[model samples]
Target: MKFLGSLYRFSSSWVGTICIVLFIILFVAQAFVIPSGSMRVTLLEGDFLFVKKFSYGIPTPHIPFIEVPVAPDSDGDGHLFQGKRPQRGDIVVFRYPKDEKIHYVKRNFAVGGDEVIFDLDNFYLRPNEGDEFIEQNYDKSDIVILNGQKYVKEPYKFKGINYNPHFRNAMRASMLGNLERKSLAMRPIMVAESEKVYEYGSVKFNAFYIKVPQDEFFMIGDNRNNSGDSRYWGTVPYRLIVGKPWFTYFSIDPDKKIRWERIGRFIDTLQSDESLIYEQK
Candidate 1:
């Protein structure tokens, strides 16, 4: 009884309070702010939210501000305890593969062994389970056939995924340039056995294809046209996955008005409530 009393006193002290806060920040939930329009309507710039760190497992806790990993990734997989992987259409927050210090949020487009086609700034997915699987799961109207294989076209449209058509020509040029630079796995090819035509001072191809490697995931932002994602840099390994957005604590637009309606709303609720989704003007 005496020992319990002493422990309770210590916990109520300032130093102990600080420790408790750090523990929560490291393993429970950490605060993050959306710094860019990469996620657009789903997550806007200046929105502050908490990230559920335990959602995908406890990644090695990093010191908060400086963003230094507190413990070495001894097993080199980046997790202290392994957990479930992110599924298709899930919005995920992860460390940028090239730079661990940077955090990026994007939707999981496809998973391991899945084939993806990028044509004219749109995405088509052929799941790893193959043709019959696509036919069984997706609506017939949404499926497109290329080279006798079925691909789901713009599968996440209901999730508010969109790209700017005005940027199509520029995006195509960028895609071809990235392919040539070999930064990502996108390779130009004529699907459905069509002939290649020349345009933009290079071979005009039907589409770019990439097969997601086992245990890796392809990520693309909801704001498709503007996001720098796996399409440009390649798939993300499970190790870099950080967590899921929990809830918006505060939001402010560029005009500096407090967005009272957004605060206290859970991420899941915001995603499913279509009326609340921002419509592009």
Candidate 2:
């Protein structure tokens, strides 16, 4: 009884409180804020959410704000305790591969061994499971034959996944420029030998293709056209994956108006509820 009382007193102390909070932030959940419209409708700018740190296992703990790793990547996999990889279609928060100091959130479009194709606007995926799995799993209308292989059109089927028809290649020049420099992982290839080249502004290119490297994931933002993602950079390796979003603790619009309806909502609820989906004007 005496020992229990002393332990309680210690826990209530300021130093103990700080330690407890740090423990939660490091291994349980960490606070994250949406800084861009890349996740749009699903996760908006100014939305403050908790990232479930252990969702994919215990990643190398970083000191918040400073973003310094608590320990070196001992295993080189970035996890102190190895965990399962993020599943296809999961919304993930990961450290940007190019700059580990930055964090990026996007949907896991395809996993290792899968193939991806991005045209001017359309996104197609060929899962590693092969054609039979594609035929059995996806709607017939969503399936398309590309170069003798079966690919699914817009396979994610999420309400927030937007393909704004009016939004043209805002990045056509830059994208084509990246292609020229071989900076982008995807390569431009004609869907067919005689297929006419598609033009955006003065830049012209056919569709792009990439095979997700082993133990890596291809990520794409829900706001398709405007997102700077795997299609522009490359697949994200397992080492950089952080965690999944937990729930929105607070949300405010650009004008600083509180989003009363969004607060306290779980990310799963926000993502799956079509009524909450923003209809592009």
**Best candidate (score: TM-score):** 2
Q: What C-alpha lDDT, on a 0 to 100 scale, does residue 218 get in candidate 1?
A: 95
Model 2 pairs whose backbones collide: none
lDDT per residue as tens, model 1, 1-281? 99999888888999989988999999999999999877877777888999999998898999987989898899988889989988988888899988889988889999999999887656899999988998898889999887788899887755567786655577677777776777756777778644544354466668878899988899988877777888888899999999999999999988999888889889877777786578754
Best by lDDT: 2
Which lDDT value does model 1 have at 47? 85
**Runs with alpha carbons beyond 4 Å of true place in candidate 2:** 1-3, 193-196, 199-205
Q: Clash pairs of candidate 1? A: none
Off by over 4 Å in 1: 1-4, 193-202
Model 2: per-residue Cα lDDT at residue 119: 77
Q: Give the range where candidate 1 is weakest over 10 consecutive residues by summed lDDT.
A: 193-202
lDDT per residue, candidate 2, 1-281, as tens digits?
99999888888999889989999999999899999888887778999999999989899999998899998886799999889999999999999988888999999999999999887678899999998999899999999877778899898877898866545567565577787777988988778633668664555558889999999999988988778899888999999999999999999988999989889999988898987776765
lDDT of each structure? Answer: 0.84, 0.87
| Span of 10 residues, lowest total lDDT, candidate 2 | 193-202
Residue 271 error for model 1, in Å? 1.9
- Whole-model lDDT for model 1 versus the true structure? 0.84
